[model samples]
Target chain A: MAKKNGLDGYCVPFFDDGNKSKFSLASIDPSSKPFSTGSKETDRERLAEIGVLLDAQQERLHAQRVQRVLLVLQGMDTSGKDGTIRAVFHEVDPLGLRIVPFKAPTPIELAHDFLWRVHAQAPAAGELTIFNRSHYEDVLVPYVLGSLDKEERIRRYGHIRDFERMLAESGTTIVKCMLYISKDEQRERLQARIDDPTKHWKFDVSDLDARKLWNKYQVAYEEALAATSTEYAPWYVIPADSKTHRNVMVGELLLRTFESLKLEFPPAKESLKGVIVE
Target chain B: MAKKNGLDGYCVPFFDDGNKSKFSLASIDPSSKPFSTGSKETDRERLAEIGVLLDAQQERLHAQRVQRVLLVLQGMDTSGKDGTIRAVFHEVDPLGLRIVPFKAPTPIELAHDFLWRVHAQAPAAGELTIFNRSHYEDVLVPYVLGSLDKEERIRRYGHIRDFERMLAESGTTIVKCMLYISKDEQRERLQARIDDPTKHWKFDVSDLDARKLWNKYQVAYEEALAATSTEYAPWYVIPADSKTHRNVMVGELLLRTFESLKLEFPPAKESLKGVIVE
Candidate 1:
């Protein structure tokens, strides 16, 4: 592994060391075998077909007037959050869907409790809300950047857990995802930005400086997952080096979650009178 | 024409009409040719095919970062605003879209001008916003229910025209649609609600009372349209008697509007330097 400055090329340490150990993939190892060989391409086609099923299921969820879904996507810069959202939800009804991207807190937001802004964006009953990047930021970025003191960060972890518990009590189901991409892949992507003029606008030299701290961020994510993953809202570590894999995984995961809800359209109150196809 | 309630069936007006002119098929005959024998099947197939095209075109528009789109869907109770939204926007990227149902104004909303609530929901640049019944409610529902006096109703038409113009200036393109279903068809739909327990919850008997004043509403709609339809936001009179026709017309209209916007994705900023996609 390459080393730069005070950072290891492939390892990031942003969270408490105890949390990093939980991400040790017992059965899914990057080095064991090629996860994306020719078979993976066929798997992608199958997933797209299931994506249609996901769309219909989502529609039924809307009509059922039951639970609300909150999809939380957490990833490093250029980890394909935007691309994945576009692909997976492209065929779902716009009526009951909402997407909110959380940027850095403004002065007003910082003045409130950490979860205040996140709560306001929650979906109402019978709707789906996608968080492009969500409350996990309170842990990941702050810890990585040392924006808060060690004591402050620990207090926030407790705050987040309580806030999520409140959401669960209120019938909000959360699906959190951390898109895992290797440093080699990230470097290649950043280099592509420098090499291709059409992509240059997306590249910031400063982003590479942050890339130097990649290992630290990875450690932080692992810790956050270990601490916050609960039965009500589980974190799924998705392989996101390949855009296709992330999209298909997210779609399949959404389908399974919705299936578990067992939603159906509310039954009409009376008998059919004069409704005919013609 | 079957007469009811001492009114000539031919003379009964359409719903959602505010003050302008008492319209009959006499002057414009805007309704398209009535279906010939066996044409319903052909129309149905056309609708499904259009759904595919609409899906693909919406995806293209989203990826290309083109002009914003506003779909204004207005209809009588059960005339299918919700269904139309589901059908037409089924394939759109949820991140790039929003759907807002204009309900009876809340107290804060009522305190402001009618357009205040509407302006808040308009789509941003490079997005699509669908209003399942929109600002037009200021003209439609209020007019049909006789909530506003003649002088007040006429003044609202001017406010609506200017509000739309402002949206256009802010880079939002508007597509306004009125779903025209015959009174007999509406009654049949309502009766079906009573007959089917699954749909009974949707029935509101008072909707029939509103139906009784349909002719007055039609006259109101004709006047509103003649005065407010402008180049920035052209109104399309969709033949909504058939669900197939309604879906295809709305889908094609959206596809054509996006095509006219001449969109292209914002090009990649630069060649990848520190980025990678494996």
Candidate 2:
């Protein structure tokens, strides 16, 4: 699926056996618009087209009731994870799509294995599920706060890879995207929110603390992505500095993935071939 | 809320202490468009206007995070429960909206009381939830199938009323809607699905059996609506034969309900007043 429109260029190389030195987060420019048509009008037109096609594809997914699709989104604050979902899925039937947002783990969540809460929300048969912020949080937040040691972080990465492999082997298709944005872009977004008091509800004073550790989070993401981007659950680096480009790229990638599934409405029921409703 | 646009005319009268004879489902016309502006184009325009307003209202509800809202939709097969949600919520932010669809119960759901599964899906503070089909099914399906005797059915209605009242007292505002369609409309809709091979996935031969018992189901609905409609959670009958009219009326009713809440974005956080992201 990634081969379409050179999307493969954005996919992280599949993790090798402890040879994770080939990938570097800094090498990718978040502002690049390789998938953009260079015209906002044209890009939006494409996005609308993708929305209609996605709506149709999702209907087939819901009809067949066989395979499951999961999309995991990870990004820094103000990176447009929410925006991407709204734009890309604007036309999909809300009934067929389930969006699960993971907030800070509660005491009960913290009491169990990290995957315990996550596994409970996995997509059912013929379902398309989105994980706004997912199990990756377990690795990202603690490591940046110096709560998780290097050895334990490495072990957690192994656990994630194994968990994802099990899901992929169980009739589920998985795709992960990391919405990449530049520091300067985030500054503008954060400042804009602060400028508008109405948007203050979406901002937090502690978000600045995360900004202070931006470099550390980037390194953590790099390590996690390098260790866990396997053949079954690859991560794509989305250039999200351009909202239009980010939405279009993600839509195109998903369109390609769905097309590969070769989904169709189940064959007409013979029992009702000529039966009339009375 | 129902006072606006004379929507009160469509509301099932509140169930008095024990006098439930004021409401009758058969008195309402399935094809009427009392809310329509006499043109399909105008009705659609109004629906679009309501959609935008609903989007803004939902955002405020989310920002406030102090109140909860639940919309319960009950309907027979092909009554447009799915269609109404798709049309009315098209513009609302998917992040703030949760759509829960209830299908037939599994062994586990049937093992416990019916409300157990529903209570688990109730809206949390700062949420707007829609139950595509709800516990009303416990009454409608069983009564129509002759498995539930009248005495037990009356007990169940009281149980629903008390449960909803408790939710209302706890800060959740609830609105229930029944999509009313004519039996002839159902025949046409079912036949249309049969004529289109791709739609066979949506058609079940059992749906014809339900249609054969249409009168019984209506009686059950009439009794349920009369017994359960109350000040805390009212039931509104939506004439759904005209798809455009059905969408518009539902939109108008919900818009009025939301406006009654006088929802506004929560006051800007004092802590974020002058703090700048660094």
Candidate 3:
């Protein structure tokens, strides 16, 4: 079967009203099942090949002085943003990668515009900045909490889109992904946390309240993807039910995005007359 | 052959002259050799021990509860901060470590107080944040360049100490290291960079201009250290002539500091009775 946009035929179908209830992921996404049960040897071999390709592409990227990448991952708690980043950039040089995890804003942050804190964290050229949760929290948390009026929420949506566009204009390639997990999966994970004393620290009783608003969050995510997805910064809905599939898909997507960038190391400064890489 | 506060015995006699430079850099401080040419194997073995110790400490830090570690590295260009971090943390779990490299502030950063940018990068509990260059740069860079008057520089000195104190109060264990490299060694390294094309990318011609004021910077560093070093965030003057020695010392110091915390895994919320580590 021909893959959809080279996504191993696992592309998220365009949101449709008729499919709203059909969005349930009771089983693994059919499109991703191909490599799910593949032999361990075959998987290892594929990973090794990808690693070599990634190394060459990263080398070229450092040399060519290409645009930086801004990867924004948004999802509900335990939706696998951290795990995805770990699996995706497992082999990448830490020097070239930056992860910014935004927590509740401090007093100083509250005094400024929502974007102020985020603007300071943008990656420089020729780097990758991954946001475990980004400026979207400004909208997501506020929207879910209903702290902002509908009009105010709508206004902020445009502001976010414009801000992302500005980042792109300044030579950042933005890839935003939302790791979507079903309520059933979240319940199972949270139950695992409650059942295992080793995971107790991760459970805050308040989380169950959020779990009750699962349908609300699903609608919010759909709205977020529809509103903020732009040519400069597109959104990808990642099925995060299966950790292995999520890991492999995120890695493959990153490899594909980086491959598309024609990067090369900048020429050596003329001030050095004798330096060589070898 | 008694070690003084874990420093080499060379430090005891020098305590009387606390005003005297702690640095033994020949070209930079003109008093002692930074490299130990003898007992290389002992140093290497010690470094391996330190590496193992540090790994254990870091694991405990991660498990005990997330604690933030802010490691500040300051020195003139080619002083080996980048190289030191690479060697010391090469095997560290990337999930728990962050290296923040500071440069000239962007326009937005400049608009805010200088500390704003630095504050944003502070690690959450349970992370090791390495500052290749940190807020100290505000004082070091400005002092060395003579861009700030004495009054302003002194003011910045107090500000930095306070900022660090606040960071420490907020559960961050701060370890600051100054890589003391001699002028002759720096010249050799600079020349090597000029001689090798691969290393050419790191060389900046302006380093020589800074070399001319090397002594002035040394005086500045001494003053800054004296003014700022405290019981909580003491400065480690590392002998950096040998790359191996420098890395080993840093690794040992970090390992020692983290071990002193006596971290334990935060008890998990749920029982992990059935889970397997593998």
Candidate 4:
């Protein structure tokens, strides 16, 4: 049995010709850390190393000033979306990175097409951007809450596939991750916040309402990921119960993805080689 | 003689109740490093310490979920706006910082009121946002290019002061910095970029056009900073000849500003005190 090595082995294959039901989200274990170095201490060290490598690669990308990269992170509450960003990109210069966190839509956002806000924040030339939450919220929330019909959900997913394809073709490398956590883990995390007064600012009663609909959200995610995963923008399931492992895996995945771009510093200019400052 | 301490000494005095010209930009030296720890290596180490402290403060701000902070960076070409962000924010979580780089406006942006695009990107509650270049461009670029008459320029500065005051009154703490670098320093920085072929992507031919109007831009900046510096939104003149000193000064300034906020994690919620997860 050949052990899964890199992130490609975990990517949900591109959905073509309406095969949205083929990928099963439940089969993956939420506790597995295939990318981890087995020891938690070693995993932290590896993540730090990845951070430096990522910082260098990002500098090159910004220097080249051509391609753009967008990372979309979607997960249940308390699944470490914020932690992963802080840890994995600690060494990457914040200059080249744009992190956009989408909260509930405001009235102005609701007035436009679902993708309007997302598109406005898309990475520009020489930029690497991350969507903390994304337009995927539109399909996931409405569908799970029964506000969107099955046909409408499928249509929206199709629209997402097309939108991502266009961005990919226009020089963006799109990577999506769903941080997977078990229901039991969520209970402990939510309870810990409740136990500490200082953490109350982070807790929302409405979050519990969403937790009540966990199964539906899980199902919605499965369908959405299955429908929109493409050769241009593939989705990966990250086991996120262990925070260190989650950071390590995400760091490795992004490092590998960036390396695949083969980004390089543009050739030196010959026009002003001998030019000296006046 | 007593030495000036903290960021207040560099701060452009607040233009309150129609007082504007009392502070002069020319009085500040672009080469001074009042905030440095006397040695370059020590200043760098101090900056790393500030980075961690700022990072912790930012986390507290995020946890509090109330106040917002906006850092507006304005400078001459090659005056280290991007470098300041990268070095000062190295330890801060990218998740908490939002960097908005304002390039030359597009036709759509130009069609709206100058502040329209900017207002849309204001820091939301709990966000620490940086405007790499901001609405100040409206005052400097046009006034220097002679497209905007002094009367119109003054009116625009009034508009900016009001806009920033509004952002401030709405619980946003605004700290603006003008990275001051000498003409000779900028010439060296720009020429070095031109001399390095790999750095061509960062160059714009139009940047040279701006450099040609250096004296005019400086005059414009001095006037605009004088007029717009207000009680609620103050601007600091950061000596930026030494990149390390620039970073250290910025880090200290922001750290001090954030500390003044007295941000704390929200108090524990009594409602969920004994509630256990099902």
Candidate 5:
């Protein structure tokens, strides 16, 4: 609820509206560089600058030991989630950052509710955490695979809305990004991996099967993002066709979010002023 | 076991040695510059170089997805554990590093065995985790406060040995460092914190009480390190009075530990040979 203004233009419309059919993934272009600085080199430099600022802010957050930050990244194959993390956080200290990549659930994870494991990894006080893929996977994956019915998916989305609301109320700042890429882009990326034997370990043939259901996945994403996007945990659709652009946009968004917190180091201890080290 | 030799001069002898009296905290000089590059400026430069090397090794470990690395840091107040983590891991990818700081136990944690909470935070495969303070706290605190009997302390040490051996056998590389700062050094550090009012948030008057019992804490540390140091899990005594020297030594030690693993990117996948995107 503490989110800054005008970001709503990039947000998926909140689901509070009774007629829920207005939002569409096709409305946004995946190749647009709206957040770019017009020069790739300039954008890279700007991102590095933001990284420095972000690090200072993060240290203040840690020193203050107050708020928590959670960034959730959800994207299709080859959407550059990992690359974005490596680039945007390249300059941030590893001491205060926690990156959790959610993979297919184990038997025990599946035994519990979808949110159980996710809640376990939520950022602690003064911590910054990222989920490479997150609870949204529950809505998107099962829906795309046709294992989840419409009403059940809706119910889960409601649960997510409630969950994020609770986190916000309890002093957490949340940001969710849905990495949007064109089907054509996916084809090129997947084929490149297939052609490069060295990259094969990162590719799975099943990805091709997922590509076959491209439209269905997009629809699933559109619905989930729309329903779960709230003032407390708004979802932003990121244009991720260009890796550098994607990294810059994500970094910029995160810097803005952190600055919104207005973090400062705790006031110097009055008692220690003028005291000397031995 | 993959640890390099000549480094053994800094290592506390493995507890398997029956007689632990030879390892004494008083024997090590906290201000020693054994790993320093002969000049403060040169030592800083060396530390930066090691950061880059550590980053590369960490990436390979992540790509291999086979082994885990755990670094345990224990030191008296202001001994520079946090500073070392920031400076040494400055270049590492945030995605591959996990820093877990163990604090005083919560009600739930107290109900379980001391190692229970620690076991849950151990590094996963392909992870390089640093415990800002660790299970060693369990040993040191109770002994220093006279809450745990000597026999119970010895038993806890056995539990740690068994637990760590299992981690190593299951593919974890463990390194523990006890940052050894002389009581005089601690007094200076504590006084500096007290004098700087901005740092008051980090200081507790109770810290003065701990300083009052400095000798007792040192003896407790000596016993615990001697008891828990093992072939699979070694404890190194880091001379930590000079911040630059401490950072350099820890950086060098970690880089060496990572290099000994011989980690490499997995062999290029053969199945995608000649395949093309689209």
Candidate 6:
């Protein structure tokens, strides 16, 4: 399990037919810093250390070329999804990491099943892929917008679980994280962007419309996470109010996950041990 | 034109119906270092400087989201394409750079016209894409292996020029580089890889077969470059016997291309100027 820094406490309980009521999003405080080392400086130091280790691990993963890793990040607007990616992956080899930002579905995309576009971008062997926002949006967004009924939402959840299980059984190691943040935190972050006129390109009035439905969205996330969290693809509730804490905890969680794989470089080639080139 | 460091001399003369014999690959010395700063330390310092500038330029490119940039790299197997990418792009934002390596075409890729797979990977607006080994391989490899006749090769070259012209007209800024390395340099590099057992994953005895056909490949590259270099997409011969020199020259060439685009950040949105989050 390679558990350290009490990361186990953050794992959402695995879903089962009879355990639906055992997990609640409201039970976890978004502002808590369970994994922090009590100071911002120390937390950043820990992050840098983890970054180096992740770079080495990723190189080995690329060398082995047999397994894949997928990190799925889900959060509300201004909850720091983009910031977390930039900071946490700052030290990873750019050659080995592929970041796919899934935007609103296009006309062609809407014509197909929700997972059609997503399946095409799944990590190939020896690749580490990050989904800035992923197929989870299919369940969360439409349900919150009243376009999906409960019966249909449950079926989509079943589809997601089966699809993810297939990916895991084949060789992918999946980790899903919901970056939980307080409503007050979102308000301040949005206001900061507004204050900086140069950053306006990243802002839109529609973002506020989503914020207005914050509570409803949270409810949607709770249901979706509960229904989809399984032994193969588990979800973690990341307390993300503090940016430094968020980056460190996510890095720690990923480092531990990679460690569990026990990745090693491929055995040295016996045939090439003493060969000479002309 | 943002030219500095005598870069103009390295440009492959623009192709035309009549200047067929004006440019020769043999004329350029692979060991030359016109861009070098005399010492490896100073060259590295200069590379670090360009890396920072490149990072800023790429940030603006991603922010503006109107124009695209594509860098195509081609060379013999051990001419350091992978190493050059790692060194030159070390400081650029990983999110902004997409490195697409073209391996030997798969059966599916072979089923289509040569450009079919390549056109799909063209840089989208606001992207900076690098093709590790590109469509140029179609002309180089097959010609060297006697799989394609001269007439067909000429036709493919025309097809490539038209394809690139369309991409340029549609707002892609293209820069291509052929990493020029002497045969002795390649021999040393291949031998080093063979001697290190851990590096065998990147080596193949078949690479020696290609080395034996080096002269044929050089002639093929000469014909392809002379026929395809154009006003829109230009190719440069990068003398690459010294790794630091190759990275610096390539970096300098790309920096100049990006500078020519005169990219700027999108203007601040008046709508978001004074709004406050509720």
lDDT of 1 by residue, A1-278 (tens): 11212112222222334443445423233222132334777867756676678778877767665678999998888787888888887766667678998978989998998798998888888888899999888778878887877688668777876787788788887777776777777777766767776556455666876787787787777667766665566667667777777777677778777877787777764334453422
lDDT score, candidate 5 = 0.86
Chain B of candidate 2 achieves a TM-score of 0.97
Could you give the candidate ranking by lDDT, starting with the highest?
A: 2, 6, 4, 5, 3, 1
Clashing pairs in 4: A197-B268, A268-B197, A269-B197
Docking class of 5: medium
Candidate 3, position B192, lDDT: 84
True contacts kept of each: 0.60, 0.65, 0.33, 0.83, 0.73, 0.58
Segments in model 2 whose C-alpha atoms lie over 4 Å from true places = A1-5, A16-19, B1-5, B17-19
Best by lDDT: 2
- The residue-by-residue lDDT of candidate 4 on B1-278, one tens digit each, is 11123666787776774546677778889898888878999998899899999989999998887899999999998999999998898888898888888988999999999999999889988899999999999778888878999788878888898899899999999989999999999888989888777787777777778888888888888888878777688888999999988999888889988988988877788898898876
In candidate 4, stretches whose alpha carbon ends up further than 4 angstroms from where it belongs are A1-5, A17-19, B1-5, B17-19
Best by DockQ: 2
State the local distance difference test value for candidate 3: 0.70
Error of 6 at A126 (Å): 0.6
Across B99-135, the per-residue lDDT of candidate 2 in tens digits comes to 9999999999999998999999999998999999999
Query: What is the docking quality class of candidate 2?
Result: medium
Residue B169 shift from truth in candidate 4, angstroms: 1.7
**What is candidate 3's lDDT per residue for B9-94, written digit by digit as tens?**
32212222443344433324422434433577876676667766776677667666557788889888788988887667755655
Q: Show the colliding residue pairs in model 2.
A: none
Evaluated on the second chain alone, the candidates' TM-scores are 0.81, 0.97, 0.85, 0.95, 0.97, 0.97
The predictions' CA RMSDs to the true structure, in order, are 8.1, 1.7, 5.5, 2.7, 2.3, 2.0
Of the two candidates 3 and 5, the one with more favorable DockQ, higher being better, is 5
List residue ranges in candidate 5 displaced over 4 A: A1-8, A17-20, A268-278, B1-5
List the candidate 3 regions with Cα displacement exceeding 4 Å.
A1-5, A8-37, A40-66, A104-116, A138-156, A274-278, B1-5, B8-67, B93-95, B104-124, B138-170, B215-223, B268-278
Q: For residue B263, give model 3's deviation from the true position in Å.
A: 1.6
DockQ for every model comes to 0.35, 0.73, 0.29, 0.67, 0.57, 0.67
